[model samples]
Target: MLALERVSKTYPNGVEALARFSAAIKQGEIVAIIGGSGCGKSTLLRAIAGLDRASSGTVTLDDEAISSPHAKIGIIFQEPRLLPWLSVADNIGFGLADLPAAERRGKVARALERVGLADKADAWPRELSGGQAQRVAIARALVPQPEVLLLDEPFSALDAFTRRDLQDHLLDLWADTRPTLILVTHDVDEAVVLADRVLVMRPRPGRLFDQIEINLARPRDRNSPLFDSFKRNVLTSLDRSLDRNVPDRDATQGPGQAMWW
Candidate 1:
């Protein structure tokens, strides 16, 4: 189990990015954290990955405090961050240097196959399309077969069709081998479709505002009324949280400027 107890983060500039946030995630469960810009989603993900330290409270996985980077935890960022000179297979095996050459090759091969990129194993990063590059990134992250995976808007940059394809791929991988995954995304529909639970956060001292459990079955149909209902609930919760965070509309909005969501 992964647990965050009263966790908070404050920068040296006195900006409190995260408040007393707390949540318990089950083993192998997928959780999505969503909020507006500057809601500390990045900070929270980094802290959980032990890339950043929480100013207060504690984050633990299986009862062990996460004070530094853990080998069992893997993070996927917004960009592919692949080395331009490396082949797809080599990039996926970058972290496996400690293993024997044969073992590393085996792991990389399996990961490439998992991401449907076995044919592109020898291809350079520049040779792949946007979606293919992201697949390589996913393969690199999954090569370790992390028990806990943290994704920070990994597919936000892709086109709608590519994004949907990657989402389907993610679900397939999860079904094959469930891992405790946390996906931080701003897209409400993405969260509803992908997460076992949705955490709606409030900004300006980022904190959890609501928790929505997804009771729907796998291979979720976005066209289904049940999916629409869940999406509506998430939107309503986000709007309510915005209502609390955003001040009077007239004062916040620029003169003669309007915004619609």
Candidate 2:
């Protein structure tokens, strides 16, 4: 389980990314964080990942304190961030630099097989399509058998068909590994379809405004009334949060630089 206690992030420039945010996530669960563009969902993920420091509060994985640096949290960012010069297999195995050659090969092969990319093991990043590259990213993150997987809009860039395919693949991967997942995405349907719980965050010094449990059975049908209600509820919560956060003048200022909650 993951526990976030009074977690907050305030930059020196006076921008408050998170303010007194707290939540608990259990093992074998998929949670989605949704919010306005600048609501600090990504910042919260970064803080938890130890990519950035929180000005206050504490984060712990199964009660172990997380300080300046975090360990065992695997992350997949918006981009693949793969090495241009390395083959897909090499990129997936990059984090396992200290492992023995044979062990690393086994791990890489298993990961590729999970992502359906074993055939592309030797292929370069340039040779893969958007969805393929994202799969490579997923494979790399999964190779280590992380206790938690943090994905920041991993499939947001792909076309609709590709996105749906990858989403299904992700669900399958999660079912197989059962790692606690925290996905930050702007897509309401994606959140409803994938997450066991969806957390809606308010902007500027973000705080949790809503905690929604997705009751629809999996594999969720996007067009089903149950799924639609869940999506509508999440979006409504997000809309209300944004309206309450943005000033009257700023409301006319166009979409805030917020990210998905």
Candidate closest to the true structure, highest TM-score: 1
lDDT of each: 0.87, 0.86
CA shift at 238, candidate 2, in angstroms?
Answer: 1.0
Candidate 1 lDDT over residue span 124-149, tens digit each: 99999999999998888887778899
| Residue pairs whose backbone atoms clash in candidate 1 | none
TM-score of candidate 1 to 2 decimals:
0.92
Model 1 alpha-carbon drift over 4 Å, by segment: 244-261
Name the best candidate (by lDDT): 1
TM-score list, all predictions? 0.92, 0.91
lDDT of 2 by residue, 1-261 (tens): 999999999999999989999999999889999988888899999988888988999999988887654547999999999999999999999989999999999999989888898899999999999999999999888888789999998888899789899999999998887999999998887898899999998887788888999977888887887776677677667777877543343343233322244
